[model samples]
Target: MSDQPPSHGTPYPYAYGPPSYAAPPPFRIPDAFGWSWDMLRVHLKVLLAAMIPTVVVGLVLYAMYFWRLVPIWIDMAEPTTSSTVQLDRFQDLWATVGLLYAAALVVAIPLSLFHGNLVRMCLLIADGGTPSYRMILSTRRAGRVMVTTAVLLVAGVLGTILCLLPGIAFAAFSMFTLPLLLDRDLGTFAAIRGSFALVRAHLGLCLLTFGLLIAVAYAGTMLCFVGIAASMPLGTLILVYAYRSLQVTGRTV
Candidate 1:
């Protein structure tokens, strides 16, 4: 018999099963930082644009806080040690504190949105997608992001107050929550749980990665506090890259 069917309508071949796919490569912590650095170099403009607003907001808030308290501080510093004067200064200090608290409350929503967008931007870069400044300003799931942030803040504060280790663990495990929310469209609590699962699977690696990121951020702050403009984005990109790695390696929830 001929090896192939003679002038058959279909090509002669043995039955073939479904194609096989190669497993994704193992996730490497170093690759995350390396790839993030590459992204930073190539996408500097977009990253910097996304980062500038955050820095500006922080600076403006700090300036406002000090400006409001400067007069009270000066009054307290003056040598007019009268009981009435001291009482007035104390009242002024309390009023200033309340005003700052109100201002922070008002700013918290937008700040949370910005942070979520930063994660979104870094995730996009890590996924080999182009990101823009406009995209940074345009955020989705703003309400969920804000609520999730509030939950984390409260939990982290309570944990820290009770014991240091729980707070540290929370910070490490929850690092990917924002990325999960943006990438997987998960609800707030679901994203938090997913992040916990991911970190749990590779607890040591995740903790080491988180610690390195903190070091990078601290180094940036040490650069006359201006290096944060670059370090923050770089650290975020590294984190997003690691999150992507976990997804590909099937380590993510």
Candidate 2:
């Protein structure tokens, strides 16, 4: 048995070959950030191309969310004269809420699919390969991405309810789940476990990387969220760089 999957007579879209660049020096957060910045600079056009659709879709979803609230707004705008009218309004409100929940579920599917493709792109870039926006169209392994996201969400929420530290731990350990699944085609639980094991083996480094990534993202938020447009992708690239480094220097069972 081999870690590498059987070739399907294709160039193997994900990063799977030898190092394209020289071995990087010891893990440094600044170095990772600098490398990620350089990647963004070199690949800005393709990155923007892939990102534009996601932004457009997200804006559409946001509009749909507000549109769904129109009924509630109208119901509240008119003063009810009778108890029956009030009851009917309440029912409509609840029904509208239900519709919103359903819409969220529907939206999650495509968002998760887009997220997986983005992970694929990041991994490919980290491997020193130039990728196209067309790669974002791939829906392969989207189910794994959705399942892993759902599991992480549930586990993280439960951990948060128990204690804040537990939630942070779950998030930190599971950082590599997406990359593993998208790059290696690992199953949901397998990817989760592999991410956990890999992070645990290099706990200090992984934790520092995760913490700094969060801090950078938070800093972006403080700049009126316009910065998030830059921070979020940069953080992702930093993590992907770490993932690629770990994958090259170590092995996951």
Candidate 1 clash pair list: none
| Per-residue C-alpha lDDT of model 1 across residues 103-189, encoded as one tens digit per residue | 766676668887788888877666557787788788589889998888887777677767788888798989998888888999989
Over 4 Å off in model 2, which ranges? 1-24, 53-109, 223-226, 251-253
> Top TM-score: which candidate number?
1
lDDT of 2 by residue, 66-99 (tens): 6877867787789877989888778888797778
Cα-based lDDT for every prediction = 0.78, 0.73
Error of 1 at 236 (Å): 1.3
Off by over 4 Å in 1: 1-17, 64-108
Note the clash tally of each candidate.
0, 0
